[model samples]
Target: MRSAIHEFPDDLFTNNERKSGAVLLHITATLYMFLALAITCDEYFVTSLEKICEKLDLSEDVAGATFMAAGSSAPELFASVIGVFITHGDVGVGTIVGSAVFNILCIIGVCGIFAGQVVVLTWWAVFRDSSYYTLSVVALIAFIYDEKIVWWESLVLVIMYAGYILVMKFNSSMQRFFMGKSSKNVANGNAATSSEMEDVKPSKAYSRGSVVMVDEMMNASPSKFRFPEAGLRVMVTSHFGPKTRLRMASRLIITERQKLVQAANGVETQVIDGKVEIENGTVPEDKPTEAEENDTISPFHIPRGVGSKIKWLISWPLLLLLFFTVPNCAKPRWEKYFMLSFILSTVWIAVFSYLMVWMVTIIGYTLGIPDVIMGITFLAAGTSVPDCIASLIVARQGLGDMAVSNTIGSNVFDILVGLGVPWAMQTMCVNYGSEVMINSRGLVYSVVLLLGSVALTVLGIHINKWQLDFKLGVYVIVLYAVFLCFSIMIEYNVFTFVNLPMCMEE
Candidate 1:
């Protein structure tokens, strides 16, 4: 028996499938998916995510390490999982290992350039996480050294990951590695140095992604609050008219305990249930100010069927039984439908991920490219789109620590959970007593290169006082280029493995 993905006859898909119209259609759709991925991630996903981070007072590392990194890396994880089942683990191993290598080398390389300067990272946080990442790589190499996967080996990877996640979550300094109350003083709205942020008072850093405080963002520069405005101009305009009461409320500016008051000389004001009440007819004539009159928010805005779209997006116990609560009602605009927009953007990423995978497979096959090469090169890069985009976005926003941490974080998940989970299930349940056949040749080579790249990155950043510079980025990209050339050569039997001749292309 063989997997459908591994081999296919050229004549099976004739001119009808290849030349008549299907090939062109798939190619066009892939390009469309790429465009859609860019727009949705940049516009909807970034906007809503930034809002939530600000409103909830989530530090960049906390957000990026757990959610942003995980969210962006989701496509890779899922693809690896499905590949495991379909290709009997060949595609999965290649994707996870290759994706980890690609993510570490390329995403950070690209972000380093986009970041425009030395991407400064916290020495302690970087040291801790990078060490953990190094540890995971070591664990992976040790576990897979036997060239077969077992249930316990998979468990080892997963447990190690869980422990690391907990450490990141509970470690106060790590969560707010480059962020704190003093982060308000960052130059031109970037993260501040230790010396620059020394004056601020020590503050408690919370872990859960719940509302912490809005006053933190209020202290930010005006431009800090400036969100993407072009896409939702019509939506914002539609909510504002002479008759419509489109409120301009800001959690960043307003307090929950505030009470509006209108006082007069002849009226006695009293606090009733913490609200001000003035009882007297002899009151001064004070009309509602333009700002005050424009402060009444609508109960429900211009949105429909959010929960129906994705129930998990609404994290309630029983969303079906109760009403779906929109995360925020800021205004009837893009930000208003933050949860909905986020869900839609995430769903689109998933849709585009599989489509991109399919497109890559068919196109590569049509060109007579080897499956192993395509899986490692084209498909691995395709699955990493979200990581590249998300990291670049965070880096450009000056959360360099978050951006860098995301690279390490994604690689950790890619190596451990992405491949480990599938291997565990296959060994424990599917095969019972048999070992899952890993791509030993590719895995061994990839692990060696991975360790080499990780060592280079760690030492380079370590010597630079935890900063990723342009030169370092160039070095990383160059190293990956070398790896790519060697890998391609290996595929063609030019770079020979001592004992694994069959690993070469057929």
Candidate 2:
């Protein structure tokens, strides 16, 4: 008899049915974990967090810096907690390091590639976030240098985070001070640039050159592309932040959904190049009023196509479970009890994180891969999905600063809060005068690579004239690939042996 289990090779089985079943279980668990995280974050966690911010009357900058960063980073944080108390390994730290690299390089690379148009970033926001993030990374490296964390070192990380929050609180004044002196010079430079652009006309309508010219115009003055929607022409002008534009776009999308009956009746609505265009010259007078928009509850969308339907069917069980367990705070009835929603959503996040880490750990063990490698690659990427989605949405809306700031700022949160809270709990609460051990020395090298990735990314953006576009996208993506390769090699001792072989069953 031969056994099919990779980790338990000595066991004999009559057939491979058991192995097939095990593989199926792994796949099922992985998919369910991602589905649970996605639903919890998008529907419950984010909505409840927003309401909490409103209730607390936190400023937009503060909310974005603190709670919003936490909301997007909840999974990584929970994963770190599980790593500390449950697994007692470096998985949590590795995940944070990998996720930081992913957020800075991969997310920015994605934004630059898929944003559909070149978006200019404000230098002050980038510099502010990046400088603080670099310091956080340096602090993390210093704390973990000996592969052990004492109570005070963890406390330092927490205190540094508090300082970051204060910096965000005073962000406006700082930004003004930084830009005040150069404001006039920038204005004059912009005038010269626009005049220079005016002299360069497109030679052909359908040529690549012509498209670039049109993109430049759109980047310079988006108001020219404004179209009437819901009896109002909402223009995403140069002065408007991408966040504001995103809100307006969401309202337009909702209003358009209300007018779907008009499209069914006689008005032809076609989705052309990702834009909903009306064929009729006249606008529909019957639009959803402000009250109606305010009262709209989230609609359950049954996606079209056989493949999509199958996915939806598979995800239905998890969706139903969450719907019953967690209160939907976005609804008007449960809206007041957002705190409850936040707490419940958080509990679910922990549960899901535990399951995800457990599955990944088992998978790594079965494959003879180190826990740090698993954490750095699969676990890191999986847990960072929410942050990736949020950044991409803002990037597409032409809010490059918000998108870039979000990626960098979330790195700070992941490093300081995600890793700090757990270490603090273990050292201070779990047992006084105790230290948490980092089993792998490779992680230090990975963190160093993480710091370099940030510098390269910021330098790349600067060299590209602060434009998020195809070229910059390619550059940063290459850097991400190199980072992953080096980290994996470092863990495997390809360059230097830093990890022990996994224990195998004989």
Candidate 3:
């Protein structure tokens, strides 16, 4: 008895091709592993943030609004500041302001629309989180106006955050009672209840469907079936079930037999001794019914949309050019050009930064708006963009808790990491004899940031049952109003706090 295995032909091109394919596969696998690691790190960061927020006993809203939001946003903040420093301040200022505007007008606005639809801000969300955000903005402006952040000023910020936390802690006790009351009020006030629970259930149902689909797909194919078009044949079996299984098998055999007939046409046939076998089988005519005849027209011939057409027009040519030119471009001279392009691009980015600041200043002057007002607006919006992106992404992923947790985590990180890192860096750079002139602007910004955090904490404590109430929103708005008024007074040099002048002394 001979062995069933047959040796594959050995050829120079064949071995070379196999070796090349193996090398390509190895490289692809390594690249994929690295990419996976990077993504895992990002996810780990998010998870760590959540743990920190929970440990601090912060509510999801507070955690997200402050910590995770700020921490994840660190990259953008660092980038903006670097841009500012690189461009001798103007670009940095513009980058920060431009980013802020992008966050508020684009990111937040879009998120608000989605969030509003996702969790209809039951008057409470609007009052508590929304209102506090508004107030935080106002307080931030006040700090900017003072143009100096004394130790007391920093203490005030810490105090505000502490107050909010205390309020929330107290509110936690009354949460159940308020929740009951709110539920009862909602029941009485409206016929329709837009519960998040409804969304939760459907997702669970979809998960179950996915599991079933996987099982069915795996079992549908047979181990022995090796048709020329095996994938297409298997798909047909999956569609029609067991009743059409045999027919599909027969059709596959017929298709392969036809191809063999075409390849071995006009070959001589002979019957020898006791054996009788045809050298070439007759090609069966595949006569079509009306429906089958109509099906001869390829389904793939369907017209695509204008957008798809445009994309294809651009992509195909670009792909071909890339395919032809990339090897040449990878050479040393071309590589240097690529490096130069990157450097030039960074410089161009700085130019955009300067242009942005100049535009904002020009517009502010034309509108008779104060520079302090512009600065405050820029910082508040700039800082808050990361929060908006984090919140929206988390909310969309159905991890609202994580999102909220992340914000809180980021806030803590910003205070401990963000501010601390910068301060440490600055301190290290300063020599003992060289007066470490603390930039009053940075100090003021820090104070405002702390104050906003504190206010949120206090509001959280005051609210019953960890629930954000509308009253908090009112408080936020009022706090913001006071801050703005004080800011205006300070900007005009009409106010003084603890012997420090209100406005910046040119």
Candidate 4:
């Protein structure tokens, strides 16, 4: 399997290679798509939330901090849910907690080092955010003790998130004040000042519909050929144009009753209710016909629930077949199957890791990974390989931020919202008399994750305002070293509270 993955392209000509490649590609793509969908859903949810917040005259900061944080941690939520089903609960718990540790120690630590220097932070924001984050960790630990999550525990988690949001909204005035001064020195100018003016301006209208339309247009493209009164709606542009841009344009068509009207020349006019018009140049000629669109779009746009079932259905059988047949087919002992699985997992991790390292270097060199965001990239880095490949293919020509944001954003998600929510749920289950055990090792790991998160939060607060420096790299390295030590201690039971007596030699 390992060799096959490395030499995948070579397998194209052979029957077995083709089958294996197809399976691998399909499985990998399915997982990536699932994660991407979750991320999109999170964004959608946040968008809806922002609209509600605006309607209630709530602070955007509260809305942003709460939803954006949760949005960023969505993948962890997904993986944990899947883990619950697949591994029955252990992997789910481990993945959530492990991912939290990964988020803080590995993801944040490595990124911080690479980022060079840490910025100075306002102690207030640091204390506030960190205190909430710390409290969350403590809550998680308290819940874990019972080995099951109760409804009340889940409610507590929700309430905690609500509280965090409230604090951000109500106390954001202080943040705005500090940010106002800080912004003057920074090149970006005063965002708060601009926002305040927009808030006070009576004619400054804010429309969720328009925002959604813009977002969709930015995601997808518009069609040149339209439904001619009764005929098929053919798209005369490239079907593979920017997806977000295309989606954005399509959204505009729905909301604004707009049509793509091509002038006698190459200019394309966005005719809205046959009144307002906007020119965005001519559409390309290679767009899909109605039939083509129907065929291609359906296969690609499989619903997440259906797609997940299909993937699992296919994966389980394929795995069973591999287990049953590999031994007979390989002319080797069946026991070697374990070896093969190990080799395959290792090879996949290695190849994936190398690709990630290269991409990170490119990003670091070109963009100089922001000091405040060094830790973010650590989460970004673990799944960096898939993200890099996806970004390169889908939004590479345009939405570069999608890739970076998705990667880093996903990492943050895995930690707070991802791990936190599920752990809360698990606690709920435990309260219902689930026979789950709260392993001491797991508790220790959780504590380590909590500590690391707090440390980083504190560090971020302490260095919120400073420019990027190199000492952060050393701190990250040290933090990671400590993480490794803790991991070894937990995994090996090196120095436990109770020592087992040595067994006599057989």
Best candidate, TM-score: 2
Name the better of 1 and 2 by lDDT.
Answer: 2
Tens digits of lDDT, candidate 1, 1-506: 34334532333455346755567765676565555444444434544564565567654334444444445555666566556665453555666667877887887788766556555666544556678888888888887777777788888887887776666545555435544534332311223333443353322231123322222232322232211111112111111110010011121112111211132123222322221222220111112231232132222222124652342333223222112332222333435567775676566666665565566556554555544566677667766776676566445433455556556767877777777777777777787666766653555666777788878877877776766667767877887788777666665556565223332122
Using lDDT, give the best candidate's number.
Answer: 2
**RMSD (Å) of each candidate, 1 decimal:** 13.9, 8.2, 24.2, 16.8
Q: Estimate, for each residue in 1-506, the C-alpha lDDT of model 3 and write its tens digit.
A: 11101111222233244344543443343233222222221222333344455457555334544444443444334433342232222223323333333332333234334432222223332233334434444544564455432333334444555444443334324333444433322210111122421231112211221122211222333231223123222322111111122222323333333333433575332212231221111112232221232222222222245864654453344234332322211233343343333233233333333333343333333344443454445434444553555455433322222223333333333333332333233333432122112222433442454355445544443453332223433444455445555544544446443123322111
lDDT of 2 by residue, 174-220 (tens): 76677763332221111112233334332323223222222333344
Candidate 4 lDDT over 1-506, as tens digits, reads 01112212322223344344443543354344334333333223333333344455533354445444443344445544433322233333444455455544444334333422232322433344455656776777776666555556656766776665566555535555554544321111112333332232111121222222222332234343232211101111111111222232232233222222223334454422321121231222222232222222232333234764576454444334333322211122322343443343333333333332222222222233311122122323333333333332212112222222223333333444655565555556544433334333344454555466557734652564422223543555566566656554544446564112222211
For model 4 the local lDDT of residue 167 reads 60
Instruction: Output the lDDT of residue 414, model 4.
Output: 49
Q: In model 4, state the lDDT of residue 113.
A: 39
TM-score of each: 0.61, 0.78, 0.35, 0.46
Show where candidate 3 strays beyond 4 Å: 1-114, 117-372, 396-398, 412-427, 430-453, 461-464, 468-489, 497-506
Each prediction's Cα lDDT score? 0.52, 0.70, 0.34, 0.37
Task: Answer with 3 or 4, whichever has the higher TM-score.
Answer: 4
